[model samples]
Target: MTSPTRILILEDDDGLRTSLRLVLEDEGYAVFEASDAEKALLTVEDPGVDLMLVDLMLGGMDGFSFIARARPRTEAPIVVVSARDRTEDIVAALEAGADDYVTKPFSVEEVQARLRALLRRPTIGDAETEDADDDVLTLDSRTPLLFDAGAAVLRRGEEEVHLTQTEFRLLSVLAEHAGKVLTRTALLQHVWDQDYFGDERIVDVHVRRLRKKLEVDSANPQILVTVRGLGYRLDTA
Candidate 1:
């Protein structure tokens, strides 16, 4: 049988941390708790964690620093949960390798929803399709489409597209819904694993970054095309 998904919660407040643990555990997730960045790093080393929830303000080693250090250690999705709701904070978190951010006073239901959505997103180096035939796609057998249920490895023709985990997740989402118009809200929900409360420019930056790796011309992108006000889409065809 498959093991339950494990989630790491790094928060300093005892009450809030316990509350989140209870709420997430009740939602059928295997939740792990850490009160500071040091413990959080230890938890990340376990390799069992499937996702992470981090507080921007911690007792020591703030979220930004934790993110910078932890990003290289794990491929799991990281969501920043904090009282810092400023646009700069959000952007900085994203820039620092956070897949998403949630403000303080957030509902447990919202957290649960975001966690589920992020877990549903396809991992990197996974194939989008289930066909055993290799001819169905030309990309690596490991990652046939950007968001295939299997694993996905970003590629540009014969070259492998080396992307940060956040960038890989963003590209995977777009490639999964290829040819379909995905609104900024939808992208935020799926790729960033959060509500659409933050600036949409976050998506724009990541998309530009992704295009730079996948497209020959990032300015005039062909694969990752903008759909005007509708947001973006991948031209798989």
Candidate 2:
């Protein structure tokens, strides 16, 4: 039988931690709790741990440090839970290697959905299927990007883009359908799984992250173009 999905919750708030555990356990996940970053670091040593839900404001060490430190130790996805919802906070967390972000006063349902989406995502090499047209695509009319499925590497100009699992999947889907506008609904269905609750903004966040690394200028992206109200298109022109 497949082992349970292990989830580590690092939150100083006792009440919120318990509440999150209860819901996660109800969904059949093996939940572990840590009240501080120090303890969370010890807990993260176990390679069996699958996912993490971390709060930025902890007792001792701040969340950013924990994320940067624990990231090297675990391939598990980290979902930052913070009261601060500023764009800088979100971007900082993402840059620190967080897979996703959740702000304070977030609905319990939303948190559960995000966890489900992360869990549903395929790990690096366990299960990655190829698209109908998995052939490498050219960028700028000269092959600058290379998708090596065997190595799970996406290289641009001799440098591999430091993309998380979710970012890689999203970019792959867009690249496969190069130049075609894909709606948010379609991206959610394709990348995050059809069961995702259509939180397309997650797509936007990840897309921005991808642009920062893949494009020369993320502010005015030339490759990944937004389609105003529709969605986005990958124009590697």
Report the number of the highest-TM-score candidate: 2
Q: Which portions of model 1 show Cα errors greater than 4 Å?
A: 125-151, 156-159, 164-166, 172-181, 186-202, 215-228, 233-237
Model 2, stretches more than 4 Å misplaced? 86-88, 126-132, 140-143, 149-151, 157-159, 198-201
lDDT of 1 by residue, 16-51 (tens): 999999988887889899998998899899755899
Scored by Cα lDDT, where does model 2 land?
Answer: 0.80
lDDT for each residue of candidate 2 in 1-237, tens digit (9 for 90 to 100): 999999999999999999999999999999999998988899899644889999998877999999999888887889898898877777777777788788998999989888888887765564564423454544643448666544567788787766677777787788778889999889888887777764355677778878886666778877888999999998864
- All candidates: CA RMSD (Å): 5.0, 3.0
The per-model lDDT (C-alpha) reads 0.75, 0.80
Clashes of each: 9, 0
Q: Which candidate is the best by lDDT?
A: 2
User: In candidate 1, which residue pairs get closer than 3 Å at backbone N, Cα or C atoms, i.e. clash?
Assistant: 124-152, 125-151, 125-152, 125-153, 126-150, 126-151, 126-152, 127-148, 128-148
User: How does candidate 2 fare on TM-score?
Assistant: 0.81
